[model samples]
Target: MSNQEKFVVSRIIPAPSHIECVSGGMFKLADGCPITVISPLAEAELSATLHDTCNVYWKATPSFSFQAGGEGIAADGYRLRVTAEHCEITASGLSGIRNAFKTMRQLAESERGVLKSTCWLLPPVAVEDEPALAFRGIHLCWFPETPTWEIEKNIRLAAYYKFNYAVIESWGMIRLESHPEYCWDEFAVDKKEVSRLVKLAASLGLTLIPQLNLFGHATSSRCGSGKQMLLDRHPEYASLFEPDGWTWCIANPCARQYLTELVTELHDLFDKPPFFHIGCDEAYNAGSCSLCRENYPAKLKAHLMYFYSLFAKRGARVMMWHDMLLNRDDPRWEGYTAYGHSSRGLDELYKELPKDIIICDWQYGYPEKDGKEPDWRTSHFFKQTGFDVLVCPWLERRGIKSLGCLAKQEKLFGILETTWHWYRGSFRKETLFVIASNAAWHPDWTPESNVVYREYLNRHLREMDQDMKSKKYIQFGSVQYQINPAPYQD
Candidate 1:
């Protein structure tokens, strides 16, 4: 295989189209990373990511002569060339320039901070590049230790790989000042931190989509010290499932009013993102209360359709979990209780829900094993039914890749790798984010897993190791946010 084909970074994961080494030359960040640009926006970006590493000089026009990319470069596409005299990165748009720097950062870190002229390193080469999909992203649900710095790094990491979308499941993060009664004061993410992270992610060219648990998963907060964000203060709204668990009573006429207030409050906090995630997944054991009984499953369907219109009126596209509507009984999930409710009528759901709403089909599992393949019909089915679909996954890289293939056949909007896995680096092949980024760009490009795994870890470990040099914490960058040190655990 050629050098580009042999390397995973070069071949896929936001891969460029063409690559040709100029031979015997390179660009070094250690030598002031100057960028000549006609746009003030590019200059501002230089001041953000590169200002700390080198004396970055940004100007309106070329400071040195070099060949630039010809016209007809795709959006978020870049052309790069380097030689012994000077190195040049050029593109017709800002996204292209942003991608070029990402390539540069990857090159610098891939070789353990060395200036070797490797393709992974900014080799003396002329290349053209663009993303495989329009909406490549990561979906983060808050874990106990989800600090501000960690979230920022993840956003920066996504940008480094040229991802354009991020879905933050900010459960009770934003200040609920508009309705403090529902806020979890102890662990609610600071409102300022959310604002800061949003701004930072924006600088990196990522559009942040805010997620709020509207119908299901409201109990997620009350499970621990995250105190009564909703149900306790407003038991009247709870779905009162069988003996105990709670989801919002969808049939209750008042529920929409309550949710509208919550949605409006979240919109105000996020400055109104174009898309909103109204988590309607696995609303297990719902419609039990007298209020939902008379309405039957129709109410279950109406809850989302009603709100989809409401959110649309406010100029936002609605996104929701697709499990409840798409759930099916599979042997892999037979014995254990599945989170997705099988009792719901999938046919009726297909007929009722709004066609414009984006469906997050989170079909997570080892989809292929011993020649048996996963039932990817849900992803394919959602698209055929006239709705945009996002395939979400965790664990199972090849299986996720398969999901992407199925997505390719349908209305594939994007891929969202859910959550931050906390496994020790030594045991895993690569972090899920890296694996996900690879799948996001080219899921059908199958290779030996071990080779791709090793390549991912080698580069990732080197980047994190470099971060340890200046900071006490084990992070990829100097901790950008302030907080008390986390308790050390063995």
Candidate 2:
């Protein structure tokens, strides 16, 4: 058999759009090989990516040569050619070059029968690739219990997997300068840390969009816990939220001003990205306050539009969860997860909301009554009503596949994979990241077997450890311990 027939097979994740194996000897990637880039814009990125590659495969960093122009390559696409003696990359932009290097890193494998070796081998092939969707992203949450290192790992992993955007929603973890009491004193992430993460994501060709719960989740804590981040300690500020402190009190002028300052602080902290996620989901107590009840849905409408206009002036477009815009009682979405109750009258706001406001429709499962795959009716509803929509899925495989397929087939905005509390533990985070990355990159690619999936995930985890310079054995695997530890010490 030819060298191409013996070595070449589909190994890269979100598999490349096009790949052709050439009949030649394997490319020996020895230490200190030369990496040439034809675009100056991609030089810095190539250096950063190659640093990781060198650490993974060689004892010394490869030499770099930069040139001027790449005419035919797309801004977000790349063409790569690998031969026995050379590996050439052609791209017009930083993102394309970054992607090309990522593909190369994934394809590299250690030389056989060599332990602790620095050399690696690559099959002779030519590849042309680019993401299918314009807004491919993953939504990650930083709760009070989450460690900063874990957040950094997730951000780096998302970028390494070629995701163009990441929505970081901090749950009582971001320290607000204006309102010091907004976050937990013990676990709050300060502005410096936030800025560092933003810069890190930017360096890796990933845009980090800030997410704040403007409507519901006023306490910046989960509903099940019933622990309020603000009111729990500063009961004096109770008027700013509903009686239960679950939703922000939109009727109160002071509450509106407080939220405005918080948004401004976070926006500036994140370097003011083009998109901001103003979470408006599961607002069960939206119109409960006496003043808010007097105005009903109109007050809510005005409150949301206020931020919409605020973001517009700041050169940003607003994104909100789609639950509040959908009526739970509507027969059209009988079996879907729609949280807009008729009493709150939030579904009516869909017509009034600005069409430019991107709707993030999150559905974690198929309809209870519907057949196997989810219909993704809510996303279609938003699109049919003249709003650009993103289909979000949590940890469900079928839901991820169905929503991703819908996004591709309907030409919707994109897919946003949410990793709320799952990022903490339980191996769910890794599973979600792998599946979501694959689905978003190529909705038509066949799902890999469990064995192959686990292998890719393990390699990803190991690469992350190398990138972070992790030393402890506990930090090596998906979980810290092989088995759950005892509950408490004596």
Candidate 3:
């Protein structure tokens, strides 16, 4: 056996470190060996996955023994050691223990036919592991009538790999009681569905953050995810400018009031995690309204602060898409939707907006670096401009080594892997999710070989696919055709 073969080999996602094969012989389980748990969260987790994970169903002798003495464990770290008599796991935190069970469940896979048979063997080894980044997450863009089972499947896959958070970029999914006219019935899901999703995610230790599209991105036509019903019903709410500025009239108090009510409704409904993502990207028609027309620059700044304050007052940590305030010095910014226009001044947005609000910097393409669109200097500028930056990427496929590199820098909260097109389903995303999940968990990982990474990702995905098949999930995604709008502006 090779020197590396001495360590226990794990097909577990987000691979662990400091692995060692203490015994060459396979460790067999004795009947009714107790699992010692130092955390209550671990207990609940073990109960949830115990049945489905392992083929053998040996009932534990005792429930739990809570005491803490895990010295080297990170925030969400674990230490596991398996031997002949008993297998034990120790972690400093509840999440760590939950994670340890996931690996153990994989390790306990047995080829033995009987449930009571203790023939399954994971080599006796001691392993110590923890995540590199505090925030490891994936982003899902929502379309009209997203199935509840579909949502559950996505969340289940993320949790299985130990990914911590999921951001659903859906302004049209859930029905808001205050504005029934704003969302179409086909697109709007029931409150009960949302509740079920919340509970399901919490059970898996994953936090679901709903992105509320507030200011801008509103139109009565095709080619946009903006809330158009509000504008169709109330044309006065439309922005002041021309050239089809698909944005709300930020100058209008009624528009602001309308969004405020919506925000309040969302706050009262879920109210867990206390974080809100206010979609303020691509507001090309900033000063388009009558009230906001005069002193456009000042009004833009005021509106920025005003919208930000609405959430800040509710004691919710605010998050916003940073394209509107993009500071790319490169010429490639022209093609970008958020570039130069007859709109509000973005030159001073980073300076004017509050420092606490997280800047979700999403760069879909423009792969050039150095002096390119958002090079090192540009990223440093955002950091210096007093913002907690999150490196967002349209990671439909392929690992984002650039974002991973940026994540190592200061002032960066973490990385956000965005799947912009709802139609573009799990095919590419499954592969990307594995890479993003690994990148987030292990910040110091070297992207030495794509072949190795693909193999590692495939192994974890194969196991997940089996789970999905067993659960009888309809394994398919349809392509949603884009609407071709009339050439005329609304």
Top model by TM-score, which number?
2
Candidate 1 matches the true fold with a TM-score of: 0.79
List where candidate 2 sits over 4 angstroms from the true fold.
Answer: 1-10, 39-59, 67-69, 368-373, 424-427, 448-451, 486-490
- Across 201-281, the per-residue lDDT of candidate 2 in tens digits comes to 997889999998888888788889989988888999999988878999998999999999999999999999999999988
Error of 3 at 370 (Å): 8.1
Q: Write the per-residue lDDT of candidate 3 for residues 1-490, one digit (tens) a residue.
A: 3434522353456667556667556555433454555543444555545443333222323233445467567877898887765567788766787688677655554546676754455567787888766777777765654555556667766776777878776546678888776665666777777777777777666888767766555542334444464454555544432235476656667767877787787666665455778777766655655666688667667766776777677777778887767634545454332442433456566677778988777766545556553353444556888787777766533336556557765637787777665323434654456666666776555433223444544444455455545344244332122333455547
lDDT of each residue in 83-127, candidate 1, tens digit only: 545556677666776677666555442334556532223455666
On lDDT, the candidate that comes out on top is 2
Candidate 3 off by > 4 Å? 1-10, 27-31, 38-66, 106-108, 112-121, 219-245, 327-343, 369-375, 396-399, 422-427, 446-473, 476-490
- Indicate whether candidate 1 or candidate 2 has the larger lDDT: 2
Model 3 — TM-score against the truth? 0.79
Clashes of each: 0, 0, 5
TM values, all candidates: 0.79, 0.93, 0.79
lDDT of 1: 0.61
- Per-residue lDDT, model 3, residue 254, is 76
